[model samples]
Target: MHDPEHGDGTSLADRPHRRRAVDNQRRSAASADQVHRAMVAVRERTPTGWHAAARQHIDGALHAFEVEPVSGCIDAVACLIPPRCGFCGWRVQVGTYRIGFAVYRDGGARVASFATAGDALGAAIRAVGKEIAGTAHR
Candidate 1:
């Protein structure tokens, strides 16, 4: 496949953005797995005040709960921490310095800046969502 944007002989996966989106998906999946493990722990333990509080904010998987996304963000679980993708689980933080986004991990952003955060995020979500629907990716 030929990409007009990069006429040089480079494969699609070799492109920075092509690789980056994949990396974001990989990290997002990892975050989701981590959250699922924690949720499992919460389920198996003697329920405590702290566990109950954390679960209140998480509210389980995206389908397990309903949310009214007011902004580009998924929900209002305190902006200090970018809430999980819900489908997965900072997970893709948006900044206004010329408008950009990144995948958050290890308490920092992974620097996946794009030309427009909303467009790219929404497009990626819709595209990937359609493909991964009713499966583990959802």
Candidate 2:
């Protein structure tokens, strides 16, 4: 007979699997929220200009990404910086390669990739400087 709650022939045997799926979704949502909050705090604290803001964003995201998760392994170092000012946005990815870095800005309209973290960071700083200059001129 069909179970009233499930409305199907499935029985208690499926309960464990369903519970696991729900738990996984909850964990994923919580993780995303944690990342978002960290990014927002970074943005709020860095309001002088895009260059300073991006620098703070990069530092904060890197710290959050380095934190160990409750389960599994972190395969990449990546973080998001929500839009702020007219000139700041970032998708910074480091440690993706054994010795490389990648970054996107202006909502991914601009992209920079590098073979070393130092080079990538320098490029990012330059990009932020340009953005700040452009905004100042406007």
Candidate 3:
């Protein structure tokens, strides 16, 4: 038989080399199978594998929204919006209304009356929290 690693003919003394080469081939095949199995397991466990589950959740939510499209690929919805001043800069596509502002170093005041106690408290909390946290308040 022809040998791959060694091209010359094998003698009786070369039996050990042939055995070692076969053993190495078996080990290499086993290791390759192990690596393939590991990659499959990782793909099953990672976010890339969760597309079906995420789509099920999104579909269920969208079904309740009166009418919505259901034919788009999952990757179509994965998007990033650059941060911007909603008042002056281009609006983000996530929502219809522009609801952001820019602030000067010095404090500025902006307010609107609320119709209910809950709404008033929520607005107050948001405004005060933003001021204390050094951010633009709505």
Candidate number achieving the greatest TM-score relative to the actual structure: 2
**14-104: candidate 2 lDDT, tens digit per residue:** 8777666666556455444544555444444333423222233332232222211122232333333332324233334444323434555
Q: How many Å off is the CA of 84 in candidate 3? A: 55
Model 3: colliding residue pairs: none
Highest lDDT: give the candidate number: 2
What are the lDDT figures for the candidates, one per model? 0.35, 0.41, 0.31
Q: Give the residue spans of candidate 3 off by over 4 A.
A: 1-9, 46-138
What local lDDT does model 3 show for residue 65?
7
Q: In terms of TM-score, which candidate is stronger, 1 or 3?
A: 1
TM-scores for every candidate against the unseen true structure: 0.28, 0.31, 0.26
TM-score between model 1 and native = 0.28
lDDT of 3: 0.31
Q: What C-alpha RMSD separates each model from the true structure? A: 16.6, 15.2, 22.1
RMSD of 1: 16.6
What overall lDDT, based on C-alpha atoms, would model 2 receive against the true structure? Answer: 0.41
